[model samples]
Target: MNKNFNVIAASMIAYFAYRELPSDRLCRSAGIDKGSMFEDATMISEEKIRNLWVNAVKLSNDLLFGLHFGESLQLSALGIVGELIKTSRDVGTAITAAANLISTITPLFRMEMCSDEIHFVIKLLPTERYDHNDPVCGQIRDFLTAFTIHELDGLTLKKIRPVSVIYPADKSNVPEYERVLRCKPSIGDHVGITFEIQDWDMPIITSNYELQQLLLQSNATVKDRMSSEVSFKNKVTNYMLSNAYLGLPSIEQLSSNFNISSRTLQRKLSVENSNFQQITDNVLKRLAISYLKEGSHTLKEIAYMLGYNDPSAFSRAFKKWTGFPPATYQRNEEH
Candidate 1:
């Protein structure tokens, strides 16, 4: 299937404003057609989506661009997903709904919620491979953290602050992180935000169960239509993208999801002039470019994200794909 992913049009627009560049130039530089991203319900390649972030940082020369962009996002920008969340019966249900339907709004990453005795955590992990050490990755984390907290506060009409914000990247702009998150962020292998457990049960000011049920019904119909219309290749890719944080899926796993034999799946893909390895490589390549262009991750980190145990091996493959070392590619993008 074609390499396409859907994103909210408003989110894309807000991200582009980082440098105050005209929309056309931003689109042209990012390899997107003018006015294409602004259209409602349009899908663009994941490469282009990544390029928007890479290019936004490059154009603005702002390491904290993602954080600022995320802060500027209005709750209305969430579109249908925001509407569904708004009408939820409580904060917990609204978050659950957001987690379940996040892919419909932004196919780039997966968000999961977990709770322990004293705290509730929301983890954000990329659906496609990406280096956690990358600045763009950090920026993305910042963006989501700020945007989510802001929305939660808005819905509840109360100050909602996380107890802690954990990031995978090495620390940079410490004061900025603290300011935006309203807490000192801890640098670690895990990337998530934790809230006091009490917040989980907080009631949303606009809770409406009846409207939520109706919206959920409509959402289900739309999702069913999307699933039925996309090709098997797309279905496989989408699954891989959403579950990438768990690691790439094996052939057996992919086949099992479709209730088909591995050989049968292979034969079907061959008829489309595509195969699993090709699809996986395409995903890896797009992700690699995204990480490289962000200019923050070490090659080793990028290698790990792409599933290579050896950084040298990843470097070799990256060189093969783009005809330049990852460092060189990153430097060129930065300039």
Candidate 2:
């Protein structure tokens, strides 16, 4: 799925990491050009970005390079939504809009903000899981967490440290991490950060109602346009994943959800060299792996979640998909 992030994300990394390394070397290592990154309305691929963090952390020899990189930027660095977020009437509005508009900047990532007691939780959920194999992805997660928090503190005129953090990295007591993030990282199923609810309603210092409305309209237009660029297979898969709570829809039902006949759906999928069953199997495999990797459910529970009645059946299918059983794969990943 060619996931892309705004060029500014790459530019920020180069600008910051280069302070300790040569500019040319950093750019070459990251596979990003110094001049091209500063261009307006440009994008950088996720693979190059993976290279960026890998080299940035290795060359700088900073364990918390991602946290530092994110803390250095202001809200204005978020390409298209920079001004929009800055102009939001309040912190809550700014953050909610930022979460929803992330797809405009990077089509796959999204944030889920929910009120939990006296705190608001923000979880970064990227739709495309294809790039999760990158070793330095944990750094990218830290960057995002600190990036949003820094902007929140700036806009709200209050130091809003996350009460808890859910990062991809293992738990650590790194003092620098606590200093930068105001909390240490904890491995969780998703990328999450928590903040006090009192900070939510704080008015943004740069709130500009009229300009914000205009920016909102412009962002909506861009988001709608980008929706067209997404593949039909992706759209189907995302829909299935999103609605999995209601149970994975059948091919006919799934096509109905897309407002098309099964034949039409199959035909379109054929152009992509895919079929409905393949899409269904893809979703099942993804869910199965996710459940196992999380290590929070029993095989029986996972089988039920995947719509299988027998644990043995789920285990057999999992073995067929991979060389080992679900439990074995989970154990290997843990080690």
How accurate locally, in lDDT, is each candidate?
0.62, 0.63
Clashing pairs in 2: none
lDDT score for residue 314 of model 2? 87
Error of 2 at 107 (Å): 5.3
Q: Candidate 2 at residue 305, lDDT? A: 59
Candidate 2 global TM-score: 0.53
Cα lDDT of candidate 2 equals: 0.63
- The candidate scoring highest on TM-score is 1
Model 2 CA deviation exceeding 4 Å by range? 1-6, 39-43, 75-80, 104-108, 130-133, 184-187, 207-335
Candidate 1 TM-score, C-alpha based: 0.54
lDDT of 1 by residue, 140-171 (tens): 66667667776665456456789998875446
